[model samples]
Target chain A: MLEKTGLPTDDDLKKVIPDKERLAKGAVVIIECFQKIPCDPCAISCQFGAIKPFKDINDLPQVDFNKCTGCGICISACPGLAIFVIDNNYSENKALIKLPYEMLPLPEKGKEVYALDRAGKIVSKAKVVRVQKIKNKTNIISISVHKNMAMKVRSIKVEDKKNEG
Target chain B: MKKTNLAIIGGGPAGLSAAICAASSGAKITLIDDSLELGGQLIKQTHKFFGSKKQFAGIRGIEIAKNLLQEIKKYKNIELIGNATVTGYYEDGILTIVQGSNGDIFIKLLPDRIIVATGASENMLTFVNNDLPGVYGAGAVQTLMNLYGVVPGNNVLMVGAGNIGLIVSYQLLQAGIKVEAIVEALPRIGGYLVHASKIRRLGVPIYTSHSLKEVYGNDGVEKAVISEINKDFEFIPGTEKELKVDTVCLAVGLSPLSDLLWQAGCQMKYIAELGGYVALRDDHMKSSLDNIYIAGDVAGIEEASSAMLEGKIAGLNAAVSLGYRVDNFLELNRNLRKELEELRANPLSEKVKIGLEKALLKREVDQ
Candidate 1:
C-alpha cells in the first residue's frame, strides 16, 4: 500500500520488523478497548498481524507503525476498551483517533468528547468527525485530537457521560 | 469453481445427516470429505451413543453413519466427493479444496451455499514428560484399537474422566488392556456417573481432585505420577503418588476446528466455555455471511445429534437461498430448537450448553 501511495516502509502485518522508524512510516495504528481492565487489543487485533500483544492480556499496546496502513478496521474488532486509529499523515497538527463508542444515542457527527489514554487519563479534548457502524452492530466514533495526544488517547468518553440505558 | 446447490464439508454423521436433509429438499449436494471413505470420526467409534430416538440413541456410531449414507443413496441430487480436503475459502462462496485422493488435484467450489460440519478433535494437555510416545489422545487410541485392531499399550493411566477417556478406557479393557486408574483434575468426574461407576465396578480406581503431575518412561510412557488437589484446585504436595503404567490416554476435552470460518471473515468470539473460537450464527445456522453456514463442531463443539440438527437447518436454509423453500421450516425449526434444548439439558451436555450460550454471547438470541 505504501508503494502505490509513494510512502517509504510497507510490510505485511504478520512479518516481523526490526527498526521502529520503519514500522511507523505510514502506518495507521488502531487500538480498541472497552473496559478499564488492563489490555492490549490493538496489539492482538491487527489482521495484517502487524501488532503483537506485548506481554500478558493486561499489557498496554505498542504498535509497529511501519506495518499499519491507517485502516480503521480494528477499531471495532477490539473487545477491550483499548484500540484507536491514528492518522497524522493527513491534516495539520491534528490527527484522528477512531475509538469505540457503544452508548445509545451514539455520538453524532461533529460532536465534542473527551479523549482518554491507557490509564483513563484525559490527555486532550476531541471532536467526533466520523461515526462507524460495525458488522456486529457496534458504533465507533472517530475523534480528531491534537497530534501530540494521538498515540496516547485510544478511547473517548461523551462529555458528562451518563450510563447507557 | 464448480458450482453446486450445496457443498457439505466433513463426512461424519452430522455432515451425512445434513446431506440427507438437503438432498431430501431436492437440492443437489456435493459431499466433500478428506478421507478415502467418508464416515469421519464415526468410523473409529465402535460404541453406541445415547440419545433420543431422533438421535438414533443406543446405535453404534458406525451404523449411524452407514444409515445416513444409505439415505443419501436415495437422493439423486447428492454427489459424493470423498478424499477431498478444503484448504482455503474465499469470498463469493468460492472454496479452495484439495482432492488428496485424486493425486492432490485442486478443486475449486463455488457452491450456491456452503455448510461447514468439520467436527472437533481431542485436546492434548501439557504436563511433565507428556511428550512420551505411549501418551496418546483418547481418539487416537480408539482409532488404533477399533480401526487397526492394535493395542496402544498394556497398562494405561487415563488422564481425564470425561466420556471420551472413560469410554476409551473401557474399550481398552475390552481389548485386553488394563486401566490402572482414571485421574481427574476436577474434584468431580465430568462424564456420566454411570460411566464412572461402570469403570469402578471393573476394579478401576476413580481418583477425584487428583491430577497427573508427571510420567516416566524410557522412550514411551511407563510410569505415572499424580497429586491430589484441594477445593481451590491447588495441588496438595504431600499427596503426591506414583503408579507403574505403560500408556497414558488424554481425554481432557475437544476443540472445534473453526479456522475455515474465521478465514472466510466470519465473526467469531472466544467463549472459553465453548472450547475455542466459535463463529457467530443465528437460529437458522446462518453466519454473519448469508451464503455461508456452520454446523457440527465448527458452530460450537457439541454432540453429533445437535450437529445433525444444525446441519439440517443449514442445508434447509441453503436450499431456501438456492430457490427451494420448505413449507414449514419455521415450525420445524421451532421443534428442532426445543429438542436441541432438551438434548443439551443432560448433565453430560450442560458444559456444552454453557459453551453454546457463551459462543452466542447473547442470552435471548434463541428466538
Candidate 2:
C-alpha cells in the first residue's frame, strides 16, 4: 500500500560505487532532467563512480562538484534526456556548460539565444559555442552555455518560442 | 494434420486460462506460443499487477505468469507447443504452426473447436532518428531486462505517457536504468494518475506538450532532442530541449495481430479504438466465420487479466457450440464472462470496450 503513493527516496545508492567526480576543485555542476520516469542509468553511468542513484531509479542524479572531471561522458550516456557538463573555469568570468541538443535548424555556431533554467526561466544570454548531432539522424545537438549561467541554465530557447512557423 | 477436442493458439494469459478452464471440464487442449517460453508478455512484466484477488492483484506479473504455467502442467490433456509460430489457418480447424528448428511440419488437426488468442504487437512511432539502435519498443526493453538481465540502455528517454510508457519507465528503474523523462504530446498524462504520481514524487518529470524531434548516437544512441508541440502536433522552435541519452524507448501504443483470423475468413472491421483490425466476435468470442474463435489481444489490445477471461469464454462456448454440452458448461461460462465484463468495466478499458461493441455487430449476425 505504501508503494502506491510514492517511492522511498534514497534507496538505490546504499552500496553503489561513485562514477562522476569533480576533476577540478569547486567546479560548478549542471544536471538536465527532461522527464520523470523510473530509471537510474545516470547514477550508474559514472565511472569515476562519482554519480549516485541514491535510492530509486526515478531519483534525479546528484553530482559531487568537487570531483566532477567535465569529461561529458554522462552527458551522452543519460537516456532520460538529462545530464550536462559545467566548467566554471571557462572565459574570464562566465561559466560554460555543454548540454545535449537534438533539435534542427541547427543553432549557428555564434547564434545567440536565451538560456533557461530547469523551469524554463531565462537565466541569461547563451551564445551557441558549438552545435553538432551525435550520430545518424539524431536530433541531440550539444550546446555550450555561459560559465555564470551554467549552474542555473538547463535548457535553451529563442525569445517568443513558437512552433516553427 | 492431427485431430483434437480443442486447439488454443498463443500460450499467454488468455490462451493458458482457456486451456485451464476447458481442461477442468474434461476436454483435451493444445496451446501454442511463439516464444520458447509459454508465459507470453507477462514474462517481460516485472511489476506486480493490480485487480481483484482472482485477477492476481499484488502479485508480480512474472510470478503470475509462472504460477499460471505451473497450474497448466497438472492438466494431463493440455498440450503446449512452445517456440511454434501459428503461420495461418485453413478451413474447418487446420492450424498451420511453423516451428523454428522443426521446420515446416504441417499438422492437420480437425479440432472440435478453435480458440485464437494471438495477442498484440507494439505500435510503431515515426520521428527523426526513430530507427536508431538505441531506440526500442518498450516490449523489447522488457525482453532485454526481465528476460535477459541487461539494461536496454544506460540513460533512457521514454516517449509517451500512456499506461504502457509509465509502467515501462517504472520497470526500467527496477532494472537500474535512468529514465530521463517521459514526453507526452498531450496536455495531460494519458495513463492512470496513480502511476504518474508515483514517478512524479521520485523526481522524474513529465514533459507534456513535448514531442521528440531527433535522436543522436554513434553505433547505437547517444542523445535525444525534444521540442514542445502545438495542438496540431508541430515542433515549437524555441521550446526544444536536448537530452543526452543512449536509448529512446517508445511506448506509444499497441495494435492487435489478427492475421490468423483474417486467414480463417472471419469478417473484420477497422476499429481504431480496439488497437487495429478486429475479428468480429460474439459474446462467446466466436468470429463471423463459423467454427473459428478469436480471443485476447488478437481480438483487441486489452490487458492480460481481461484476455484470460475472454479466453475462457471462447474456450467454453466453443466447447458447447461443438457439442460438448451447453447445459453443463453454461454456468461456468456465465461466470467467466461476468468476470471479463467486470475487468472491462474500468474506465481504462473504455476504448477497448467500444471496439468490442463495434466488433459485436458483425458477430451478432453469426450468432
TM-score of each: 0.66, 0.68
Reference interface contacts recovered per candidate: 0.00, 0.01
Error of 2 at A33 (Å): 26
Report the C-alpha lDDT of model 1 over B102-133, residue by residue, as the tens digit.
55688788888888888887787878999989
**Residues B217-318 of candidate 2: C-alpha lDDT, one tens digit per residue:** 778788899999989998889988899899999988888888887888888889998888998887888888667788788888877778878877887777
| C-alpha local distance difference test of each model | 0.70, 0.70
> Which regions in candidate 2 have their CA more than 4 angstroms from the true location?
A1-165, B102-106, B325-328, B362-367
- Poorly placed runs, candidate 1 (over 4 Å): A1-165, B101-103, B361-367
